[model samples]
Target: MAKATIKQVAAEAGVSTATISRVLNSSGYVSREVKQRVMAAVTKLHYQPNAIARSLKQDKSFTIGVVLPDISNPFFMTICRGIEDIVQEQGYHLLFCSSDEKPEKEEQLLHLMVEKRVDAIVLATTGGNEELITRLAASGVCFILVDRRLELELSESGAVVDLVAEDDVYGAYELTKQLILAGHSVIGVINGCMGVSTGQDRFVGYLKAIHEAGLEHDPALLYDGHFTEAGGRAAVRYFLQMAKPPSALLSFNNKMTFGALVELTESGRDIPGDIAIASYGEIEAARLLKHSGIMYVDQKPYDLGIKAGQTVLHRLEKGLDKSLDRDAASPEPEPIRDILQPALKTLPS
Candidate 1:
């Protein structure tokens, strides 16, 4: 059987080849009705574009590299799905890697992505390779920083780095404030690494609420959970051994929340009865465990992923502009920082 071509697809869709190109490449504006028609025709004919030929003509690999801290985390997985959905429409492939929250591992994976010559990268950085990331972006590698931001001044190098992340400080403040409103004086905090941006911002928020509520600064109530299940469990164990155990607990992320829950259950403690709990992020399992009155801030990971994908597409489009004379008086394109607000969810008593 002969392979279907673009010409046939355009003819079947009742549109010009240019229109077909625009739709297939996801480059220009095309009406939803026309897009649907073109897609239907392509599907009916089982049309497949020659990726090698396209790559050669365009000088693009049509591949996007994605690096996240933990692949096992459902939050990251949802983000990946959003990115895949967006890039796939533009005929781009994804090369995914997990850094395991290690800066060394993240650097290695990033180097590998550069070696692979991916057209762009979406990274949830481990927050330790600021220089390397800045250099790569300065070298004209399109990057969309997802869920985390680098502290270095990338704008100085004229590097195009876009950031799409939730308002971590605000979310943490709201979550912690919810516990405070519930009349908890000693609130235990299961925190992630203090070095990371999210961790630092969340800790700031927690402290802000604590101070605003006139709670004393108790160093012993804070436990570093490192954003892991084990860390969460260890924090609970430590809290239990404290001379004055906290009546309420606040976990920084979903993984730590799970860990804390497990520890509490094993210790024969009733959730929200003996000890109240709140989390900075949602636990997917809570939906299954009906009536689990866990107060949490819904970070909307899937939506965040979608926004990141859109940002990547926008950056790639801008990068394709050959008309701009860089050495001329054209001003540098400012880096985009998109901060999304997460909703605080409180269950009814």
Candidate 2:
């Protein structure tokens, strides 16, 4: 039996070799119906689009590329697990890379993935280049934006994108409201930088809750945590040095909370006794903090990742439904946006 070739696959599918090439490359405007026929024929023959046999740049690599920020973070890693659960079963290999929260690093990684001819990309995104992302998605390589998303200006870019993330506003609002309801008027926040969308949403939710309670919004209490543990530690130091430190504190994400907790423990302050603490995400090393009260939201990181994986797979294999065509809307490829709610829990002091 002669090994299957593109020409053979095209003959088997009863379509022109040119059409077969376009479908395998996922290029041009072939109707889904025709695409399916070509794919079926290729599958029946167990065809492999080897670089030696054809134009390597135009063939589907059958690999999914993943780009994330702070790969050390368990939240994102759990999301990766979720994604792997689905994509791996479909016989798609995953190539994971970390952006280290740098947009330039992410850009470099993206180019590398394209150069390698990955079929699709699932990105946590550091923002800073919406047009590039749009073009890549429209260029036949599928892109799914997960975790942090593109800024609003490009949220509706005329490109097909899938987004799965935590509902930042909801998580922040719930945490802030919990502290306010507990009778803490003097509250401080270890917040992510406002330039980031997640950071901005969390801050806005904090403000919304504060305003609803008719409390004066004090700029002095706002500490930019810069989405880092060091930032949280520094915020803790700044707040502690104040003549009147806030009675309660809120850290936007778990990492910063860990930093603040470390600083507070060293300073001999008691949790919920000397001060109350609430945060948007869970803290690590729970055993060490047994004596302290720490309320946190479960960002559902793992489940969020699974959803992202499914969304990307859907776009690649099944494609998007015409009713919600992302390209038809201002955003073009209609984003299959999934926002999971963060569940709140608390430890008694």
Candidate 3:
């Protein structure tokens, strides 16, 4: 038996090969009547498109590309879960990739997604790839910036295709403010690599809180981390070795917290006894602290994902609804930078 071809399907559907091509490639415009005919013909012929050939003709692969900084990060994993939920339900496949927080890697992935002609792309941006995103948008492929704000233009353009993120500055500021109010004068900060948006924002928030409290930044107590256990461990050691160590510490994420805990334990330090600790996110070990129930923000990756999925689906449906034509008044929903508030828990002092 011979393999089915576009020609065969085109003939069966009573449409030109070009019309079938448009429907298949998801490129250009095709009248609904013709699109349906092509689809029917495709079904009738039981045609299976050659992966390479189909990609060439339709310029689309019916898949959503998800790019994250670090897949291992719990926060990102939660976001991935959210993205996967919607992509799977919508019958679209996901092409998940990690940039490892590198700009070059992010650029490479963006190029690949464009080349593969994914239906759309969801990115936790590395900030340096704004031009790449802009160029992709110019090419008419839908892309959303997740986790990080791309730029002022991307946020305001309403051309962003999609957006879902947190109110990082405010959340971080509030978190740090709590530590100050707890009466810790010398506070040590464990910051994630400052290259990313979340890292920078959180750092800013920490500074804002300290400044508001009339505290000056101390170089001896500030340590930048890789947002992992190793980085956390390193920061803990750095702070402890200082002649005048901070009376309390704050970590940027859960992984860092884990490392910080390991170091503190090895050094025979007691939580809130020798020093107090605060972290940005939840970790299992946090409960072992003087107060486990409170402290750290609940970023809510699951909820964020659910909302992001719904947002993308709404956009997709709007695109598919003939009545909601390209010119229709359904303004692309406002870019949602969903900044969730962090909950504070206390350790037994």
Candidate 4:
């Protein structure tokens, strides 16, 4: 059987094709009664609106592009769920892409989003590509930053566009403080690569905690891990063989934490007995640990995702007004940045 068209639906509802189209798109003005009739006809015919035809007519795909650093990361999945919830309500689809922490891949995905004419883009960008992001913002493509911030050209008009991130430094500071209170004098840190803001901020937090606690911050205890399980395991091995092995170990991210656990288990080392282990983020690995007093910080992934979606919708509804300076008292709705606090959780001993 031939699929029902907008014209057919309109005829069934005793209205014009334009009216049916308006009701379908949920754009422009249509009376409540007319909307009900159109919807009734739609249900009766089981008619589906052609997204392509609608896009051509309205010059909108009703699609939002979500470019993530790594889809395999469970944290990103939580954020994706939040984005999905908001976009679905508006009948918009998500064009999801993972850059896998590769700068070139990120660049390609951004270009594709522009080419596809996505309504907006929410990206977790690598430290590279400030110029491309700046250009996107200048061209009026709604862009928002999540998880990672553009370190360079951040002050460049429209470079960041919008931002939603955790208080990385603070979370790290809090985590480090907890270790100190546990009487850990010599602490080892498995840090993420220093290219991203998260890594740098975390290192800063670790430094602050060390200084405030009046403990010597030994550079030897620090190891730059690529935020992976392998890196965590390697750091553990490096620290264990040190002249004075650290009494406590801090893993910067979940992947590193995973490695730390595996190494401890395989090497027949007891956690919280021989070496106390802690990390930045909470996951099943942290939850299942035998040590009841394990400490970590939660970045509130779901909230960050929801805020990212809200930021884009606000930009869409109110339009991007870059003319308004943030320094001003009554600034226009320029690029909004939301930084949420990370919650600290300590498992009972």
Candidate 5:
């Protein structure tokens, strides 16, 4: 049987196709009675709205592109779930891509999504590619940055795209202070990639905490792990080989923390016994490492995701229309920035 079309639904409901569209899109004002009648006809006809047809008519794909660094990371996965909860309900689909922490790859993925004409893109950028970003902004694709924001050309024009992230600097400072209070002055840090703001700010927090405690901040005690498990393991190796190894270690993130654990366990170094360790986020072995004195900050990744989703959808629904921004000089909508404060949680030793 041929599927019921919008025209058929309008005829059945005794209304214009524009009225049916208003009801279907839930946009504009429609009388409650008219809405009910339209829906009744829609149900009676078993008519399904064709997204493709709507896209062609409205010049919108009704799809959101989500590009992040690591797909395997549980934090990002949970964030996606939060975004999905809001976006899916509003008749929007999600197009997901993982950049694997490479700047060029991130740019490639963004370009591909732009080509596909996604209504908006939620990106956790790798802190590179200003040229690409400039082009994307000029093209007028709505964008929201999640977890990390790159130091690109957007801020120069004061073109702040929507961003949702944790307070990494304060969270890191708070975490380090706790370690200091625990009586560890000589602390070693396994830091993540310095390319992104999260990495740079978190390290800054560690420095602030160390200086505040009046502890000797040794240059040799620092290790750049490049935000990888292998980097974490290498940092541990370097720390263990030190003539006077740090009594306490701070892993910048969850993945690095797990790597630190692997090194500690393999080398027969007892946790909080031989050395103490903590991190900014939870590890995969959080359960098994319960008695290991591994601390983490609850960043509420899922909540952050939901907020990011809300920001992008609001921009799409309210700010812009299907008519793309052709003029570069027009004052774009102010970008929204929401930062959730992180709380420290310690796993008992």
Candidate 6:
């Protein structure tokens, strides 16, 4: 079977190729009667527009690229859903790639997105490639940093980029404070890698709570879980080996929380009995278990995605298209810093 062409559709519809193009692109207005005729012809011929040719002609790809640290994580998946809900209405497609928390992989993915001529990129950076990110943004690449960000402000580096994330510092502080208020003087922290902004901010928040409580900082209680399930299990084992273990525990993310729970259960430690456990993010499985009693901060991943989507759309509408060369003298718009507040949920034991 042969693929149908625009010319064939136009001929069948008894309309010029220009009219067919206008109708297909929904550009110039065509009469209602003509539109129906053209659509009918399109259906009969099964004509499909060449995406590459259309993008080249219009200077727009109608595609958004997304690079996430871990695509398998439900947290990131919710964010992707939010972004897709917004962009899909405007006839834009998403190209998703996971960097797997590796800098080299992230760098390669970023370059691939540019080569594919994506209209915009939503990234959960692995805290590497700040220089390259800055350079690309400066060169008129539309970037929205979601969940994680660089060390230095991109605007300060002369690269305007939008950010949509939760208030990690405050959320972690409040979560830690909850454990402190529950009368846990000695608390253990299953922390993530301190390389990314999220990891750093969350740790800072935990420290602030400890400082305010006048509790002596025990370096032994801190375990770097590296935001992985295996790391979480190892951290639990490390804490168990300590001569004076913490009465309470805090896991920074859902994955680590899960690992901690599994390790504790297998080791015959009762929750809220032997040790109270809190988390920076909610664990979905905890809800199914009776007497879970897990205190957590709800980071609205989907809402963060919505904000990122809205920001990118607004930038594109404001003539921040990657196809156009930005004028040097033109003042750049202030970078968007949208930080959503997290909710603390403390369930009864």
Name every residue pair that clashes in candidate 6.
none
The order by descending lDDT is: 6, 1, 5, 4, 2, 3
- The digit string of per-residue lDDT tens for model 3 on 101-204 reads 88999999999987777777888887687777876765556767777766557534445546677777877898889988978879989998777788888899
Per-residue lDDT over 218-302 for candidate 4, one digit per residue giving the tens place of the 0 to 100 score = 7888998787778989998999898889999998888888888888888998778888877899757656767646788876888
Question: Per-residue lDDT of 1-349 in model 6, one digit per residue for the tens?
Answer: 8999888999999999999999987899999999999999999988899888888888789999999998988999999999999988888889998998898999999999999889999999997798899999888899999998777666555677888999899999999998989889989999998889889999999999989999777888899998888878898899988888888889998889989988988999988788888998888877765676789998898898889899889888885533447677766678888989899997667
Each model's lDDT: 0.87, 0.82, 0.77, 0.84, 0.86, 0.88
Model 2 Cα shift for residue 163 (angstroms): 0.8
Clashes of each: 0, 8, 10, 0, 0, 0
Report RMSD for candidate 5.
4.9
Q: What tens digits encode model 1's per-residue C-alpha lDDT throughout 23-52?
A: 998999999999999999999999998776
Residue 31 C-alpha lDDT in model 1: 100
Tell me each candidate's TM-score. Answer: 0.83, 0.79, 0.78, 0.83, 0.82, 0.90
Candidate 1, residue 268: how far the Cα is off, in Å: 1.2
Q: Best-fitting candidate, measured by lDDT?
A: 6
TM-score (C-alpha, index-matched) for candidate 6: 0.90
Give the Å shift of residue 311 in candidate 2: 0.5
Scored against the true structure, residue 190 in model 1 reaches a CA lDDT of 93
Model 6, position 306, has a per-residue lDDT of 89
Question: How many clashes (backbone atoms < 3 Å, residues ≥3 apart in a chain or on different chains) does model 4 have?
Answer: 0
Off by over 4 Å in 1: 1-57, 288-291, 320-327
Instruction: In model 4, state the lDDT of residue 346.
Output: 78
